[model samples]
Target: MITDDTTVNGVRIGGAEAGSDQGARTIELPSGARAEVRKGYGRDLMRAQRATAGGDANAVVFALIAEVTRVDGRKIVYEDVLEMDLADVMALQAEVIDENFDRPPQRASQASSNQDSQSRS
Candidate 1:
């Protein structure tokens, strides 16, 4: 269960979900509903993969929401997410992508070093 101050992957998650801000871990919809999102792990990804076996991009997003998020601190299923309003659904999707896929920017020096190393190999 995620609380107001839960930290996932060393990033503290709190407040309403915002765009490109890594500190938010909660999704707030225009309808006043809220969901607490947790950082996804391998098992969660496996579950999402199984739920979205048809290769549907939208289904994959909903499946991940089902496997990794909680509404009012209770676990929700894929059907629940599907039943939500499009705005809410999209908000959840954005949060899920941020939680699972967003990465910190690589330093320019590191990028250059990697490129140099690759060229030498």
Candidate 2:
């Protein structure tokens, strides 16, 4: 089942031309690096959770990103992400959030309010 268009270096490619992999997406970083990110499995999430236990929110984000992202065909570890530029980290953060977090629907109050600029007491 190895096709020239799909296999590279004995590994199968998994995006766009390959028909897309479920729970996986590619992210282009601000630093000009391309990363393949996949939804974290339960074990991946647990690993991040354990590593970030008692740490700040940012620590959790960093750990999760490290656990799920592969940049330029290389697996980046937590320390690698820690050393990345702030902008790149933020870009990855946005992608990770987009992939893993579900956005709630717009609130009715926000959708309906403030149309006339009249302040109600």
What do the candidate models score in CA lDDT, each in turn? Answer: 0.74, 0.75
lDDT of 2 by residue, 1-121 (tens): 5453586654345433232256678878889999888776655676687898886778888998998888898878889999999999988998887656567886768635775345653
Q: Write the per-residue lDDT of candidate 1 for residues 69-90, one digit (tens) a residue.
A: 7777667889999898988888
* Residue 26 shift from truth in candidate 1, angstroms: 2.3
Count of residue pairs whose backbone atoms collide, per candidate: 0, 0
Relative to the true structure, candidate 1 reaches a TM of: 0.62
Error of 2 at 22 (Å): 2.2
Q: Score candidate 2 by TM-score against the native.
A: 0.65
Q: Model 1, stretches more than 4 Å misplaced?
A: 1-24, 99-102, 106-121
